[model samples]
Target: MTASWTVSQMPDCTDKTVLITGANSGLGFEATKAFASNGATVIMACRSTERGRRAAIEIRDSIADTGATLNVRQCDLASLESIDAFTTGVERDYDRIDILCNNAGVMAIPRQETEDGFEKQLGVNHLGHFALTGKLLDLLLENDSPSRIVTHSSGAHEMGEIDFDDLHRERSYGKWEAYGQSKLANLLFAYELQRRLEAANVTDTLSVACHPGYAATNLQYRGPEEAGSRLRLGLMKAINAIVGQSAAKGSLPLLYAATARDVQGGDYYGPDGVGNMRGGPEQQSSSEASYDRQAAAKLWERSEELTGTTFTFVLD
Candidate 1:
């Protein structure tokens, strides 16, 4: 039987603890609110402490009756040092992490390299999350019941092609192409992680991927120099108005993937509307390339090498 992807149907998460990267705004912010309202302890892992505090306050105010607590911590996904600090802090405080939402990301930014010399988009969107998840694997495994890791992907992954030689985009770069590649990496990592989990007999944890179906979020406006031309900014706003759904609505698929009882490992989800661009939640298939096991395996190796992190769960 097919499962319904509605937030209203989400199982009660009163005792659950969720950590969402990039919880300062947009879909992450809405998701923070959703989980907090359900009585989960929400950790907002953001790059900016100021913004993170504001977001946590806003969420707390919105869900006062639930008595859920929001913790704000600083973590720059583009930097390995920051990732380590964030994980260490979490380890010092929390004993178990029930849900990890790898949702922080940068999109369509100008060609740039992170401090580690990796491309900005790939570093923040994939490798950083890869390292973070690896560091926190012990805490996730400590949970006796099913724990979840939801990696946020995008429909743009359909246009992505992983170029191993130019993974850093040093030779050539286009904003959208690099963004798509990073998003594709997110899905590939999710699937590959699930494979490794099952092979290692780690039945208590699940890894899943999800997309927010053209949500009206700050992710749409980010760029190299913030779109200097009014015409360009106007054009983007026009496109968003024409196609985007509200952030809350767009977060349903992710919420479903993270919390739905019947969801399986490696399931990909998106909106259930025209072109899968803007609507309610539903299970959706990704590109044929995304399902290539060989590519996924290679990507997994490259990710481990790049991030210098390895999973305890070995892939067969």
Candidate 2:
């Protein structure tokens, strides 16, 4: 595929089932619309079922007669119990999942703890998806053909370091630092997952990571809105207008990773623009730290201990 790959280049997704977290808005929502328009059964796993339903209605109204099947289910990544409920429902209703997008995340908000007491950014962005994937592993593995798990990370991961001594940031916390840690954790998990699957000889499943470089989305405004700082919000709007790409454009890397036939596990995709910020999706290398196998192993063990969910695979 060319570096300028677009959704039009995607394979026909008919008869496929895709589960996208945070599907009510941003990249996930755009992905939902794209996949559904191509005749796939799209599950919108959202934190708010009400918002999810409204988003579904909007997609249906806009796309008129694409034979899209969309289902909205509630899944709050900040809460382990909510993920449990969502995954359980999915397991009961769907026998196989062709794609799973671990896309929902919280950005640089004021430091807070999740329902399970993890740092908010690390909790929602990394650990939450980890637990959800473990719980739904059976459905993904059930696919006769290869299934894809596309994780959404960010370029900010380059600035991150896994503070093993203080994973929850109870000692100190800067919002951006926490966000970076979470994003870096995403890559580590994606790569490690692929390694584990390969070690177990599980060829029918692929794990990949992608990022929407500097995409303009609600995520930009969320932190300022949460902080009730209009100044920060206004600055973000200005930055978005001048420097950011459209969410639809930013979402292409994820769409490419999810559906591209040539995609391989452990691959990372991002925009091909200057500094990897804004352009068509292309295969790219993540930070050197993201490939640290030792860090990945430690994080994996800590995550399982914290989330009480362990992924089991018989390794050779």
Candidate 3:
């Protein structure tokens, strides 16, 4: 039988606390709404405090009957300093974190460096979350049941090949290539984190990866102006009109990874439609490189070293 999953199949998140990065818009926003509506305390972590607060208010207005609360916090994923501040604040206020959804990302933007002097894509999409997750590992591990970490990857990761020498594209830069590298890093992080957790016998913490497929999100507009010319943007809109799934639908795979009882560590979730792009949530596979155990291990080591954050749980 084919594996099947949908938002409706998810268990109630009542009394749970989910912290979602970039929860102000797109799939992140929809996921926040879904979790909060199910009675979870939803923390909306956005780069913009204004937008985050507005999103929180919108969720409250829409789900008044659920009696769920939304908390807004500022976190610019491109800045390590900002990430530190955000995590410190969260730790001070929240006793435990039930779920952490690393869903915020940038794609197809011009070559630029983050405040920390790393490539913007790699910094924001992968390293930032890496640092954040490392900092928050204590709270995540404190839970009695499995607390989940869901990294948002992309199907484009199939084309990614990491270049350790030029990870920041100091020699040459291509927007899509950088984006792909970041996404691939996300999958690698998820898989490797699971390995570490298992080796440490921390079965109560699960790490999974997910993709939203081709949903019509603001990420599509990250290209150059000419790249998003009227004709191309119009064509994209036309395609979205015909086949684009709702953001809520796009978020289902993440919800499954975060809450489904049967989901296992390192499992990947995505849409079940053609090319895994436009249907409900289902267990999915990734490129062979994404599953390379050796690479995952090396990447994990490099990530810890580069970010200067070490996990207390050491893999045997």
Candidate 4:
């Protein structure tokens, strides 16, 4: 792994179409800029078209023209209907997608249900992206060159479990616990997707997972602000100022996973700093549970049932 890997090291991506969810702010926004600047056509899939348009304008004005096209499309991952509509539109307009970054996610927030009646964090973070990836799998496989699906996870996954008995936390819910479980689910889904891709002999498609480490992003404030806890929000802001890295630095792992030539199908990338919390991108092992094939398979089956979207791949 290159210890000094930066976005500038990204390979020429002209004509490659990269789709990123939650591209209006934080890591997703930074990644959008990086991919566009490197000559990739970027699609900003935001929940709010207004916010997505604003972000697109900001990128167009801020980034030097690189012949990269930036398009903002409406996509609310919290709703399966919205995901379907967004993907349908994407399929209508584009025949191939070179990269899909499942970067949109909800952090530790108060217990709430999505439009689909699932826990908010799990729904938006894991299941939503799961459905999105499954729906877009064909577009990814259509490209002649290798295409990648980069799912953003976190260090919180280390403390998580499947909790199959209480998958939705309907019986009980803790903010951070649910967040950890969702992130762990991200890893499980990512690894499982890679395995399925391999079994199906799809050599040109890769499913990789990554983490931004402890980057100061609006993600931290969403939970506190949602719960109306000013104290918690303030504390999060302080922590971000003191301990978190810049969003640009934090997004390196995602860029690496998306564009790095050396990346394998199931590789996981994160920060190289102590505790995997900050610094440049580096390949690293995920938690032991993330490698549980049985758990991953079970989660995948349940996800298909919940989302009503089945992956098109036929596994051996």
TM-scores for the candidates: 0.96, 0.98, 0.94, 0.98
lDDT of each: 0.89, 0.94, 0.88, 0.94
Q: After superposition, how far is residue 21 of candidate 2 from its true place, in Å?
A: 0.5
What are the RMSD figures for all models against the true structure? Answer: 2.1, 1.4, 2.2, 1.4
Error of 2 at 198 (Å): 0.4
Between prediction 1 and prediction 2, the one with superior TM-score is 2
Ordered from best to worst TM-score, the candidate numbers read 4, 2, 1, 3
Clashes of each: 0, 0, 0, 0
Compared with the true structure, what per-residue lDDT tens digits does model 1 show for residues 1-316? 1334456677888889999999999999999999988889988999999999998888877775776888999999999999999999999999999999999899998888888988999999999999999999988988867899999999999999899989988989999999999999999999999998988898889999999989988787777236566676677788888879899988888898989877899999888888888777778899998888999999989999988998876323
Better of 2 and 4 by lDDT: 4
Error of 4 at 86 (Å): 0.4
Pairs that collide, model 4: none
- lDDT-based ranking: 4, 2, 1, 3
Off by over 4 Å in 1: 1-5, 224-227, 314-316
